[model samples]
Target: MTGEPSSMFEAIYAGAEAGEAKPPWDYGAPRPQLVEWAEARDLAGGGREALVVGCGYGADAEFLALLGFRTTGFDFAPTAIAAARRMYPASKVNYLVADVLDLPRKWQRRFDLVVESLTVQSMPPEQHTAAAQNIAALVAPEGTLLVLATTRDEGSEVKGPPWPLTRAELEEFASGGLILRGVERIESGTWWRAELSRGAGGSTSHARQF
Candidate 1:
């Protein structure tokens, strides 16, 4: 039998049902830094497909769809997915209730861009490595994996629905044999965004210069 619903999940479902939903991490818009990086690039053009992991209420997914990418969004919580669907009834985004860990092997290397935002840090400590592998597998050859995550330098242990990541933890993608192309830190004097990527070949790379 499935385990009883967690309090966090229950709250999300109730909020959705009551029309009072608000994601804790909701920034009211696609993270401004992400918007800048994505818009500056030539990634989303001419009907490309992009995948969004941990799409809470479809804010980012909505923006991607408007930008011309056929977007698909996944979140583990059903309530959030429902709200997202209603919020974008005419949207082409294929929002679904699915856990990142439970993603099928057949989905490997399937997207032109894998846009992950804070999803990796939400996992339990022991699951971090596997999560990296999953994210890497979703990116096609020559495709870009634009990641936006929080980095902690204090070596603090994370007890959370949002586990903080460190530089060392970010490097775990290389262990899965991904070639990091670049990493850029987005500091708006408020939040930090670490954007990491991997090339098709097996070589680790960084792009902190952006």
Candidate 2:
């Protein structure tokens, strides 16, 4: 990670300047799994507060906003946030530039639903735990955290950027007073999706559909 862009912001900013499409996990659309979850839970018109982590081009944030959630999308890259705002000019989602590891203190426990898609795996392996802790800190007392990331078997060999997380690593997000409600494998087992709840009193309502 030396000499090369060590942080996501640097990498993405360079990619954007180079006119690359999908820079890193852009996917060009909202995640289908998220759509399914939203539909299953009838999130539309629900008016819940939502936060989108590393909200690349705002697709996921826009989706949540369209569903009546007051969505806020943040990314470490200024270019990414700018592009997201431009891509969805008519959207109500608030797009901002912010680091996942050191988010605004006021944002702690501020959202009812925190959506993290591929954001955790984008960081260096050494930073994964800190990223997870920061992510968990964003959930409200009774909020839900939805995590979607690439997965690898324990002790698997690592390649390059987009290091895949193991099941145990994903479950570790439940630390810091959060509880793991459910874990599912999606995209033909290439991905690990988990639902965690904060202070839900053992209720699995948000994860029951999975």
Q: Which number leads on lDDT?
A: 2
Native-referenced Cα lDDT, model 1 = 0.71
Residues 85-187, candidate 1, lDDT per residue (tens digit)? Answer: 9978898999988887889777677776778888888777678888877887776555567777777665777667677777777766643545555566557
* RMSD (Å) per prediction: 3.7, 2.9
Per-model CA lDDT versus the true structure? 0.71, 0.82
Question: Tens-digit lDDT track for model 2 on 17-85?
Answer: 687645756677889988887787777637879999988888999988988889999988777888778
Estimate the TM-score for candidate 1.
Answer: 0.83
